[model samples]
Target: MSKVDFDEYVKEYDELLNKNLSFFSKDDSYFCRYKADLIKQYSSKNPKRILEFGAGIGRNIPFIKNAYPESEIYAYDVSQKSLDYLEQKHPYAKVIREFKGFENFFDLVFCSVVYHHIPVDERQKATNDIFSSLISGGEFFVFEHNPLNPVTRKLVERCPYDEDAVLLSPGEMKNTAKAAGFNDFSVKYYLYFPPALKISFLEKFLRTLPLGGQYMLKAIKR
Candidate 1:
């Protein structure tokens, strides 16, 4: 699949995303805050520096800031336009287009639904780069759509930016991180029910099920 240039979609990014995912939540921040909440609940480390990998358009910026207001936050993406939008919207986040002199720099690296957009062959190299950037014992939090879930598959099929998406399984995520030298890997499925069918209490019990619309993978650089 040919890579989609995100720069072209920076203008209509939010609209297009909402068109597809609005069913889950009318407010876009609902999805963004979910990741931040997961981080806060699962993480044991008080990172001095946090990195938002593939932070396109920075929807998560405010929530991340809310979660760690004092920690220095850095945003990185291949799309300059997306980075520009992120910078303009959230001045607190320092944006960078390239990874240079950043090894062992970040205490936590976060990625959300970004891996599917990456070309399959390049994923290993990208994972390796993330591994190299994190400080020893730093955590990497990655969230991705689970292709096993029919709803997620349909959403990806309908979204324009996801035209080239190749969804990865939970096993693939664990193995890829392992190959990149990540240890203590853990993964939990999410979005088990849509807005209407969702039962808050039962949701936690369903996290181990692999049929959720999405999954979160946590790994550490040990």
Candidate 2:
């Protein structure tokens, strides 16, 4: 199997996602909103410009837009069809179909479960590109599936669109950020509860646990 052709999955993406990964929040928009919310939570200030790296069909666009309604919002993706569809749905965002280093342009860059799709050999360049795209104090927020979790591993192995996914551990994620010149890094494991579990309150107390279904890494450019 090769990398996923996201264009083919654009229309059915939401249905497929919720059907499989609603364990995060048991909400129709959990996967998308969850990440967008995380970005907002960690942001030090209201960023003047925001970019969604690998935006794919713009499922996360609306939430990000709402979070930074006064800020400029931009989305980038390799799939032209997905970009086109996303643009139609979200004319507010400037959609980039091709890759160009924004070059110290974004105040914040957010990626949600995207790096696993990059070829293992190219992840270094991707990180470096992101470093170049952010300002001196810009922040990068990354969310990735936890390879250490059996259920997350099973989900990735079975996901059709995840054919190219190479799950990186928290340490690998940290090293990639460090090599890219990102400092003041903070890593936390989350999604510790299953679907509709009332123990959501306990998640904050368990950030150090590695058994969570997913993990988030926050890197700041200094």
Candidate 3:
């Protein structure tokens, strides 16, 4: 979308995400629990630094900061309004420009539901930038929407969502990571239902299966 729409969306995204967070938090859906676990798994408890790209509104800051209270947390986003909100919420985080030369600088770098906002063509360049920012052997974690989900595909296209959003398949994500100078890349599916759905048992069962509606891809810097 245009800059105006991006700004407007940022102004309103909290309401939308807050609703989902509330719904998902009621029963600790596997996705919710799984996301936290994934972050912990990638983040070293005694990390000296952390970087989060596309960290709109600092949604993951609280948990990340809690997990590594002594580490410095740096974030970057293109939206000024979103960064404003992030600064308000997480004064401790240092906001940078786009993801450039982030490689080998952080012990763990992550993004949540954010990579989709990257254009399909430029996604690789973005991944390269993310890779450049990481420290050797540092892990990268991404919580992304699954493109194979018919329901999600319909809604994302139907809405006046960010124009840059491009859902990618599991294999596509792995390839992008591999092309970005990463090794040991892998994608793990999770979140088996629509955000509005309210069935934890069903979510858990769905996640246990081979296919799910979302995923968390973990990779290491080579």
Name the 10 consecutive residues with the lowest summed lDDT in model 3: 23-32
Root-mean-square deviation of candidate 3: 3.5
Highest TM-score, which number? 1
Give the TM-score (vs. native) of candidate 2: 0.94
TM-score for all predictions? 0.97, 0.94, 0.81
**Segments of candidate 2 deviating more than 4 angstroms:** 23-26
**Distance from true location, Cα of 16 in model 2, Å:** 1.7
**Model 3: per-residue Cα lDDT over 1-222, one tens digit each:** 532245567766755545444443443333444676667765544568888788777767777777678889988887777888888888999988565545478877887777788777778988888888787878888888777776556556655654557777767888999999888866667766545555644654454354665777888886
Candidate 2, residues 70-132, lDDT tens digits: the string is 999888988888899989999999987766847999899888889999888889998999999
Please give the CA lDDT of all the candidate structures: 0.90, 0.86, 0.71
Look at candidate 1 and give me any clashing residue pairs.
none
Clashes of 2: 0
Report the candidate with higher TM-score, 1 versus 3: 1
Off by over 4 Å in 3: 1-5, 18-34, 42-45, 101-103, 193-210
Q: Please report, as a residue range, the 10-residue window in candidate 1 with the lowest summed lDDT.
A: 192-201
